[model samples]
Structure formats: structure tokens, C-alpha cells
Target: MKKWIMLSFLLIYLAGCQPFMGGQAVIDWVDFIQWNGQEYNGVHNSEIADASFIEKEIGEVRFKVADNVSNPSYQLKDGDAAFHEKGTKLYSIKGKDNIIAVKDEAAINGYRIYFAMDNSKYKWHFDDVSLEQVKKIEIYKSATPAGNQQIATIEDKAGIENFLEILSNSKEAPAFQPNTSTGDPISYQIILYTDEPITYKYSVHYDGNTYFWYPSETAILSDDIQHFISEK
Candidate 1:
């Protein structure tokens, strides 16, 4: 009787400590598919894939495994922007909700070029000067109380242009499956201000792999953009 009682207690303890015990547990999808071939043979059945048991035991386990996998670092190229200097403050206007003051010459020029190209008003603005003219560029968020949210800083004019081009091409879409551990989607708000007190707001979001913008239907972040943000 004592032996049976102890066995019951052991089982209870294991169940209570399942999370810790199953921390490293993972489901082999390839093996699972092979074994349950008939179930998923012809039709696209998500019953097993979206099962709560599978999510808790296997899906969550896969997420943990992915977390352990180290992502490759982004490589820097010959004209990539350097990290911003410490204590740099982003300027904000008094009455404007999203207006910001841009002092960096290169960033100012880049914005002008971006706006001109976006409106199709003046394609010749960039024709006069080469991208090599701009040495460095940086973007900062004006929403924070301290106004010190520096998003990205790039030194290569070509890199900045590429970034702008991506922004100009993105289009809006409905939300997709998010890959975050918290199960919440990641979002970004890019605010740009011009001397005319004009404000441009761009909304970007991450679907685990890449960052996409809504308006232009473009992917602003590729390997290079990822590297730039990560490096900073």
C-alpha cells in the first residue's frame, strides 16, 4: 500500500513540474508527418497542427528551439552609416504632434529627395548631386519625452536611398501570423519632418522574418537593413 501511495505522489510531482521537465522537449515534425502520413496525406488538415496539446507541447517547444538558434550577424559595407553620437537629442515642434527637427545635412537632403520622388513633383532634385555627396544620415523618433529615440543611422548615401526606396514601395495588408514568443505583433512608427513643418508618418511591422510597410507594399528591411538596425 505504501509503495502504491508513493508512486501516486511521484506522478503528481512530475505533473506539477512538467514545465521545467519539458523545457528541452521538442516535437520532430518530419517524424511526426511520416508517422501520421495518412492523416495529412491528401487534405490540408490543420486540426492536429493547431491543436492545443500540440501547441503547448510541440509548438512552444519549437519556439524555444528557435530561440536557442543564433541568427547570423549583418555584415557592414563600405559606405554604411556609423552609430550616432551619445547625447544627441531629436528636436520636436511645440504645436505639431509628430513634427521633428532634422539638423543632419545628409538626412535633410535625403528627406527632400524622398519627398520629391514620392510626390513625383521634382525628379530632377537628385539629378544634380550624386548619392556620394551625403556622408552620413540618422533617423530619430520625436515621441519620447526625452526625444532621444534614435532609430537608425547610416553613412552611405546609397544605403539611405535604398532605405527610402523600400519605404516608397510598401503596401498595406491585413495582419499575418506573428512569430514572437509573447504572441503579439511587433510594430514601428517612423516620423519624418521637413523644414516646411511637414510630417510624414510611416508604419512598419515585423512578421518574424522581415519588416514591411503598409502604404507602399514594400519591404523596408532586408538583410542589409536588419544588419544596420542590429549593428546600431
Candidate 2:
């Protein structure tokens, strides 16, 4: 009798613990399937099924982006990189290894910092893009790190530790709001996901209309710069 009762309770708990439909777990990707009113064309003396089946698949992925300007280290990819989007002068930095892409330093809106580690292929892949995950980024148009500004210098000793703590405890990547800093009417956002630990850093800039997503990875050469420039 005790065993039966324990088993019953365990089953009930497990049922409630089941993840959301379509494997909506923090680590699993799901595919959506739509059955068309068609038939499977193949037949073994069987009539063609009058249904079309469309399956949407999503894979588990993870991404991370870190602003470690002091560390001259990274893993790079030597692939054909380009800014495929139109109307914007977005750029990307990439190469075959981590160090090749590391340059002396670069500046965005007067701040010199290293590229965020996000463009590598080995770590980041999305089987399906979730419309619900997309967000309208808010760029801090004249916000700067001042006495009363929200932009905090991440270079301090405890700053890095605090940032890492946030990442470890967060269910998703924390969004960066430029409102904390004063700058060239521009701000950056770092997006993260739980599928896989692949990071993509973005700099958002507007030209009167749409906002652009500039890849934050560093380039190995002038040619490499051409690969990651994109507009969205």
C-alpha cells in the first residue's frame, strides 16, 4: 500500500513538471507541424493522402556576449562574412581564430572597447526564429556615464564580478539600455538565449527610420570587416 501511494504521488508530480507544449524548455528546441489537407504522395498500393504536412522545428541553443576589453583573447571564424541587410552601414568583425580578430582597440561613440564575443559559428545556431522573442531596442540618445547617469563603468574591479553574477542567475540574457549613458544618440543591446551559449552583440543606430543591428565582433583585416556589416 505504501509503495502504491508513493508511486501515485510521484506520477502526479511528474505530470505537473512536464515542460510546456512543443518542448518549450530552456534547453530544447521544438518544431511546429501543420497538416495540410493533402496526402503523402508515396504509395504502396495505397491511395495518396490528401494532406500537406508542414513542420516548424526549433533547436535548443545558447549564446553569450561579454565585453572583456581588457582581455586580448577570443576564438575566431574564418568564413565569408558580410552585412547582408540593406540600407544600413552595419559591420562585423570575424576571422579564423580568436586572436586574429583582436585589434589594438576600437571606439564607438567615443568609448574604446573590445568586441563582444558573439559571431562565432561553433556556439550559436537558431533552427527557428521566435517572433515573440524579438524586441524593440531602446537606445540611449544622449545618455552618458556621469554623476547621475545610469551608465555604469563596467571596468571596475567589482563590476565584472557583478555582471557575471547576473548572467549566472538570469533565465535569459539581460538587455542593455543606453539610457544609462550619454552618447551619440546611439546605444547598444546585448541579447542572449538559453538554447545554446552563443552570444551576439549588437549596436543599435537609427537613421531617421529603422534601427540597425551592427555585429560587435572584431575583424581580423579590412576584408573581414565587410562580412558582418548588416541591416535589419
Indicate which candidate wins on TM-score.
1
Our model 2 lands, by Cα RMSD against the true structure, at: 23.2
lDDT of 2 by residue, 57-126 (tens): 2111121112211112222122211111112111212331211111111212211112223342222222
Let me know the TM-score candidate 1 reaches against the reference structure.
Answer: 0.32
- For lDDT, the strongest prediction is 1
Tell me the deviation in Å of residue 225 in model 1: 2.4
The lDDT values for all models are 0.33, 0.23
10 residues in a row with least lDDT, candidate 2: 39-48
Quote each prediction's TM-score. Answer: 0.32, 0.20
Per-residue lDDT tens digits of candidate 1, residues 12-122? 224655652334433222100111111111111001101111111111001121223122222222111112232322333344322222234333222111111112332
